[model samples]
Target: MKKIAMTVFLSTAMILTLPISSHAGHANHQPQESKELLYQDMLMLFLLPHIDQAVHDFYAKQLTASPVVYPYQVEVKKAERVGGSRSFHFLITLETTPVVGPHIPVGTDRLRFEIDPTLPGQVKLIQFEHLKSHELPPRWRHMIRRPEAIR
Candidate 1:
């Protein structure tokens, strides 16, 4: 009888505290994590459009049309929340090279992008400099088509 009473009391106490502890944790850090994820989203949004521009600037005067830019690397310069507001911003640079029959170009480009979630992002071409390169095996290259490309 004593053992049963003790067990029941402990279970009741634990059940009662479950929500309070959960609420405490949620109240403390969950919102911050959400804000961090918002910054991450801002980073992605800032990166997408600048990629083609990077390719264009890298191959300027070389290719009459914009070649497919293979984004070899991504660098996030800044990602943070706006001052006392629900806005976010990201400054990012994308390293890219033109597709030249699997040969690396003379140098790659660093395309800088800045985005204010309050407004549309803008594009800028920073530079073209030679960076060391390595090759990686195709992870998902098997999903291939002959003439056309997948978006």
Candidate 2:
């Protein structure tokens, strides 16, 4: 929980500071973001809340004796602004492996977000795809069935 809180705080700070950072070159110059850059930024903001959950889910499925580690990677494959609002569409790929499975899991999830720049706290997830491409191992399956097995 603390990790997630810290991640959210950091991501929020980074996003909020991007405009300032980009315009730091000259006092009179204001940075203008290209459409692509804006889209990428919006896509990143959209994915921020999900990163910790993805990591947690990835670690929970592992049945190995080795210590669990951050096992997932998220990549933004494509991003586009929708209409004129601060809404965006995204295509993201998440790659990881199940804790006990021998196979690698790769999932492509589509996401859409509506961001109100003026009211940053009102950012909303318009759409989400919970993508999972691999079956759990026997041990994990058993643990999943018995909720108490989860610590």
Candidate 3:
């Protein structure tokens, strides 16, 4: 009878503590809005420093025979949450220069950033696809061939 009473009392105490502990645990948790804002700030800051390096590396890797240097720009095309993961897509353009050859025409690529859920505010580059300048829209294609056309 004593053992049964002790077990019942312990179970009751454990159950009573669960709610209090859970509430306390959640007390310091930030709302999703603030968490997302933090994530965005982290993402922007992380990408800004690495964009130039990534562009240079891509060119060096893709064109091993002749290392070419071209003015490059990265434009964030979109950022969206798909399923449980956040994704950032960027249009990377390496503008044509006076010395650009037929083989190394104006370069364009789609850079994709897949958020690493485990790392919270970090991202992994999932794709870096080379896009032909001709594949773009007519106006964009023209702009690639003649950059001054738009300006």
What would the per-residue lDDT of candidate 2 be over residues 1-151, giving only the tens digit for each residue? Answer: 9999999999999998886445346677868869976765565555566544444544445423321222233455444454556555323443322233343332334444555454455455455554543444454454353333332
lDDT of 1 by residue, 1-151 (tens): 9999999999999998885434344444543458756765565555655666655554454433344544233444444443546645544555555444344342344555555645534444344443532232364233233212211
- Candidate 3 on 1-151: residue-level lDDT in tens? 9999999999999998885434345567865678755665565556644444555555543332332333333445667665554454332222222113443444555666665455445556666665643233443342243343212
How does model 3 score by TM-score?
A: 0.35
Root-mean-square deviation of every model: 11.3, 21.5, 19.7
CA deviation > 4 Å runs, candidate 3: 1-45, 62-72, 83-106, 133-151
Q: Candidate 2: worst 10 consecutive residues by lDDT?
A: 63-72
For candidate 1, what is the TM-score? 0.39
Q: All candidates' TM-scores?
A: 0.39, 0.35, 0.35
| lDDT winner, 2 or 3 | 3
lDDT of each: 0.48, 0.47, 0.48
Candidates, ranked, lDDT: 1, 3, 2
**Candidate 1 local distance difference test against the native:** 0.48
Clash pairs of candidate 2?
62-99
